[model samples]
Target: MPVARGTKAQSTKQPRASKAPSVTENVPPQKDEGCQAKRSPSSPQGGPKKRSAFGDITNAHKNQAVTGKKEGVKAPTNKATRAPTAPTVAKNNEINLKKSLKKTPPAEVPVEHEKDSVPEEPVQQVPVVEDIDKEQLGDPYANAEYAKEIFDYMREREDKFLLPDYMEKQPDISRDMRAILVDWMVEVQENFELNHETLYLAVKLVDHYLVEVASMRDKLQLIGSTAVLIASKFEERCPPCVDDFLYICDDAYKREELIAMETSILRTLNFDINIPIPYRFLRRFAKCARASMETLTLARFLCEMTLQEYDYVRERPSKLAASSLLLALIMKNLGGWTPTLEYYSGYCAQDLHPLVKRLNFLLTYQPCDKLKAVRTKYSHRVFFEVAKMTPMDMMKLEEKLKS
Candidate 1:
């Protein structure tokens, strides 16, 4: 203790150890943390500084700090040397992402609401007509189903109001006699090129009047023949005389009686002489098909033949006409079928065969071979039925026809 002596270790360690104290203790804890975290005016530094965190530091400051010298340093008085600011673009992008996530989608438009908003205007929808060939339309006969419905309706109505027994018991005529009458009448329609509807109308009138009013004991043949006589005058330009009808009826009806009954029948029909026939429809359908005259003729023949069948008489006039025409065309080997008939029938392609079979059966069962001459003379067979008379009665009718 008398003399201050310098050790070799103490001298060397003194400067190095002293430098550590200044460097480690001189930096303020709060300020250092603020400088690294973010540059802000409200930080522990107490004043706004423009320098960024990334801004370069002066070489003099670095040297002084490394030497542990605090000659001019005052707790980093140049706070302007602040850390670089974070990217503003990055912060803004993050805010925008949050906003988008909270946004709602637009609502959908409703059909009814949109429709109500539109202006009011009438919309014209055109009817779609099938573009069938002219020939196909020439035959107007439709399906038998419609015909059946019509006939069924009529028959049911008739059954409800059965005629008097006196009227039902009208003179019986044999199948041959009826056939003979019908044949002649069919010829008459053909010769004059008369409408088949007229014939059907005449037959309908006869059947109705005979069942409802005419005495059963009276010759039913007379009533039938007279109904035709009246119908012909209404339908044809050239009507036959009462004598002509008498001749056709084989003298079964007198001129006075025929005239009287004709008046009665006319009254019953309400003078509605314009009976619609399938022939006109047949022509239309055949035209649609572009069919030959022979084809049309055959279709017409079929339509006329359909008239004799009890089913056709009961059917809708149009449908009966269409079916008949189709059957005729099929029989004649004419192709190019129109769907018009099928549409009316509400049938598929498969249903046509059964309809045809029914038609054929009806036609086959109703023979006209024996009535050829008589029907030709009358242009109508209103009172003829092959099944209604016996062979002896037929002979008498034949004898009368010859007379």
Candidate 2:
């Protein structure tokens, strides 16, 4: 009646075919694909995960479905057991990944936005000086290829302004009279607040002219003022007018006389007044010594005092600056000339000894009133009255010199 009942062969084939449907429903389509095909071709190991990122989850569901049938357990029929769509699963995962990336950087790469928020160097909260040992001399011509040539030119031209015959030329003028004129020049320089370089250059120009021309004591002031005028133009930002200088001289010299002397002095010096001075060397030495402000100020006071001595004209500016610095160091109770000073100045203690003695005599002679301008200027509160400081015992200085 059942048309050959239920054929035994047909019954077995039907059950086996039914099992194939259950396996296909549990496993994902992506897992059936070879790992090579599912991975990115551009990646070396096809990267960590690609289309098969959910392969493990898919396999877990597949195993549960297979075990349920073997153990005679009912397969889950809930919506939670619904087959996962590859497109939907990938989309959901992509969203979660994007959110995680925005939270924080998993990689060590620096963020551009973060770098802009931090400063490269810490800000200074207070005014402070650089370390003394780290302080260095300024080199303005450090980049100039012909810097040595320029220096050599300046040095070579210095002899042209030299008063080698200054003693011979000024027969009628005595050294003390020159000292008095220099003292008055110091007063003029201070009153105008001229640059120290200008003062030194003015003195140099005056000495140069003195070697070429003979002027009376009354005319000396006119000549000195004119030299200051020219030097101010060369070195000062806003040099005082010829009239201002004439007024400083108490109108003792007329404007026409000052003008005449300016022209004559320019002619006598051949307009070659761009010479070096001791101030330049002194500053370099002071920096090397790491000299304090007061020590440097005292050294300057001693150096400017040398202008009063006619004998100092013969010594080189470098030696004069070195001796003055050593004397200032000793006078200020600072250390003596250090090895650094000797190397930079090219003068050892033995070389500085005679010059130091000469400077000591000038300090001793300051109170006698022969040359009082420098002492008077430095005695003010602004200078800290370093000029009034007494010299230390000569015996100790001698021991230092010998050592």
Winning candidate number (TM-score): 2
TM-score of 1: 0.44
Tell me how far the alpha carbon of residue 40 in candidate 1 is from the true structure, in angstroms, after superposition. 51
Give the best candidate by lDDT: 2
- Looking at model 2, the pairs that clash are none
Q: Cα miss at 394, model 1 (Å)? A: 33
Off by over 4 Å in 1: 1-181, 187-197, 214-218, 247-252, 339-353, 362-403
lDDT of 2 by residue, 1-403 (tens): 1322333433321122222334546553332223223333234432234333334323333332222122223434454344333333334334433433353333312433245335643534322433333322254545344533554464565565455757666767777777887888888889899999998988888887887787777787788889889999999999999889889888898888889988898887778778788897788789778898889889898899889888888777777888999988887767777777776566787889999877877776664466688889998879988888887567876776666
Give one digit per residue, the lDDT tens place, for model 1 in 215-302.
Answer: 5434556766676676677777877777777776677667788778777776876665454444555555565456676555544545
Error of 2 at 353 (Å): 1.5
Local distance difference test scores for all models: 0.46, 0.68
